[model samples]
Target: MCLNSLLFFRCLDALVHFKHLTSLIADHNPITENCFLPPLPKLDLLWLNHCKISSLFPWVSKLKESCPNLQHLCLMGNPAAPSYFNGGTFYEYLQYRLFVISQFPSLNHLDDRKVTEDQRAEAQRLYKRPFFERIIKPGSGSFSQLVHSSVTWSGFQNKLTTLLGKDKPNDRNLMI
Candidate 1:
C-alpha cells in the first residue's frame, strides 16, 4: 500500500487494521518517530525515501521494536540521510566510518543494497554511544537513579525475561 505525497500526513493510525500488510510506501509524508506507537509486525518492506525526516537514528531505533520483520528500507533522499551519512559520503567513508546498519540489527537491505556483515559490525562498534544513551538516559532523569531503582530494574528484568520466554527468579528450575 502506498500513501505517498500526503504532505500534511502526521500519523499512521489509519494503518492499524492492516495487520497483514507486508509492504508500505509512505514516502514524501511528514511521518515522525511517534507515528509508530503501534507495531506493524508483518511489514517487510518500507519506503520512506524523501520526506521531512530530520534524523534517522531515533526513527530507526523506535522502528526496531515496531517493525521487527522489516528487511528492506529506503531513506535515501530524506534530510536524515545526510545527518546519518555526513553529506552522503557514506560510500567514500565506508572503510573507516559506520552507517545506518547499526541502528537496526535485523535490517538486511538498506537503500536497495544488501548490508554487508563487515559494515554491520563496524556500525555497531561506532554507534555504541547512541545505543547506550537510548538505554541509559532514555530521554529524561539521571542514569544513576534509573539504575538504582529496584522497581524499575525488576520491571525491566521481568519484561526481558518474558520476551525471551524464560522463567522469572521464583520460577527457575533449580536442580540443587
Candidate 2:
C-alpha cells in the first residue's frame, strides 16, 4: 500500500486492517518519531523518506519489533538519516547507516543502497557495544531526554511546530 505525500502527521491507525500487506510507501508525510505503528508481519519493504523522524535511538528498536521481517527500509530525507537537505554531515550520515544496519540484521537494503556485507560487518564492529551506553549511563531520565539534549534550539522549535500544528501561529494572530 502506498500513502506518500498525504501530509499524515501520525501513523495511520487504519493500517491495521491490511493483514496481508507486504510493502508500504509512506514518504513525504510528517510522521513523527514517536508515532506508534501497527504490526505488519508480512511486511518486507518500507519507505519513510522525508519525514520528521529525528534521533533513531529508540525508534529503530520499535521498528524492529513492529516489522520483524522487514528487509528493505528507506529512511533518507529524515533527520535520522542525516541527509544534505537537513545540513547533515557525511560523517553523521555514515554513522546513521551503520547504526541502522546494526539494529536490523535481516535488512537487505537501506535507502538507495543495497546493504553490503562489508557495511554490515562494519556496523557490527562499530555497534558491538551499545553506543548510547558510552555516552549516558543507566537512569539517564529516559531516552527521549538523551535525544533532546543534543538537538539544536532550532530543531527543538521545529519539533514544537510539528506537534502543535502550523495553524497555531495563525490562531495567535486572531486573538489581537
TM-score of 1: 0.59
Q: What TM-score, over all chains together, does every model reach?
A: 0.59, 0.68
Candidate that scores best on lDDT: 2
List lDDT for all candidates, in order. 0.65, 0.77
Q: Give the CA lDDT, 0 to 100, for residue 151 in model 1.
A: 52
User: Which 10-residue span in candidate 2 carries the lowest summed lDDT?
Assistant: 167-176
Tens digits of per-residue lDDT, candidate 1, 28-117, equal 777765576458899988888676666555576677777888888887667666534446554433422245576567778887578888
> Roughly what TM-score does model 2 have, to 2 decimal places?
0.68
Off by over 4 Å in 1: 1-8, 83-88, 91-99, 128-176
